[model samples]
Target: MRKIYVIGIGAGDPDHLTLQAAKAIGRTDVFFLLDKGETKQSLVDLRERMIRGYSTPRRRIVEGRDPDRDRAPADYTGTIADWRTRRSQVIEDLIAEHLKDEETGSFLVWGDPSLYDSTIAILDEILGRGAITFEYEVIPGVSSVSALAAKHRIGLNRVGQPFQVTTGRRLAEGWPEGADDVVVMLDAQQAFTGHPDAEIYWGAYLGTEDELLASGRVADVADEILSTRAEARERHGWIMDTYLLRRHASD
Candidate 1:
């Protein structure tokens, strides 16, 4: 039987790749790269660059086409279900074609494979079908959450306080009931607006030389962040950012 390794490549920086992750890449027979279309071409390029820098010639690169982002349904639940289904098919096909004779193939994931990433989730479903008999291994990498905390020079969780990690959509729906510290990712609508009393430390393009950092009370910094994010996106054509929010006791 063959084994499939899902390895997290960390954020953008080559130095962020953990030793285990690098070793996994070096050992794999084939590598799968996700191409999230042209809008995110840099993401694909960055992964390629990392693989080139770290992996030996024994590993072959295979590119996977991204599902059509426009095809996503407006309904959140249905959209995710549909996307996952399509993604699983893509992976199944890729595996059959590329790894037919290989004992181990790997997929390089951005950030941590376990956090907010759907790669492992989709793969789990495919494996559950029992159509393919394969062992799975997850090589963890430094998540954007840790990168953000390090960039800001602050701990993610307050002393003796609980912290939560959530998406911008959830934050927009409403601040989670009892979180003292919240790390928000995949923010599209600037969900910080929902929390009036939180303090925020936001970073964009983390680990890259062009990173932008800002900190202030949420209410005061929210608009600035929104505007800056817009301008930054316009200038760079894309942005990957994360932020930490805390409801200060004094507020």
Candidate 2:
């Protein structure tokens, strides 16, 4: 049997690495990276920096080309299912080739693995095939949603109130039922613009030097967020953002 660590590296901040995550990095024999190419060079650099700082001198870094998929497919669910299958295949190959028996391997994920991330699922798919066997552990880290709330100086929920976490696509369709406060992620379409009456606290490229933050009633700040997001995306060639939308709050 082999060992695998699915460690959360946190939103873009280097200091977000928890003590346990650091120990896992130090223990890893191989770091498996599925490169998405130069558009994410900064992210790649940050991961390399951490590995260099914490891993043992004998540590090996293995690279695999990440499978690309349609960003705006007509059948979103089916497209994503196919994509995940391809990704599982790539990761399975990496583990089979690079991670040796009795050695530890790691996949450094952005934010907590339990939150909307697919690495855990990919690993499970590999395991389900009965081709490889490995004991795996998940180490949680801070998420961009927490970082966004912190930077905005707000709590995710009102006292004694419930909130929902969802995606931009779902938010664009309509506000969630039974929740006045919503945390939206993977919102590439500027979905906040749809809720003109709601208050929005938005953050982009959180925990990085290029971070941007803005908040106000959606009608007032929607233009600013849209334009600013466009400029940032042009400048960085990529953007990672999330927001909290509230139709009502105690404060």
lDDT of 2 at 55: 94
Clash pairs detected, candidate 2:
none
* Predicted structure 1, TM vs. truth: 0.93
Q: Which candidate number maximizes TM-score?
A: 2
* Residues 1-251, model 1: lDDT tens digits: 77888998887677999999988887888888777778778778788887788778877888888787443247988887888889898988888788855468898888899998888888888888877767789999988889889988999887788899998888888777777788999897788877767789999888777688888897788889889999999987888899999886554
lDDT of each: 0.83, 0.93
Q: Model 1, poorest ten-residue lDDT window? A: 65-74
Give the residue spans of candidate 2 off by over 4 A. 249-251
lDDT of 2 by residue, 12-106 (tens): 99999999999999999999998998989899899999999899999999999999999999999999999999999999999999899999999
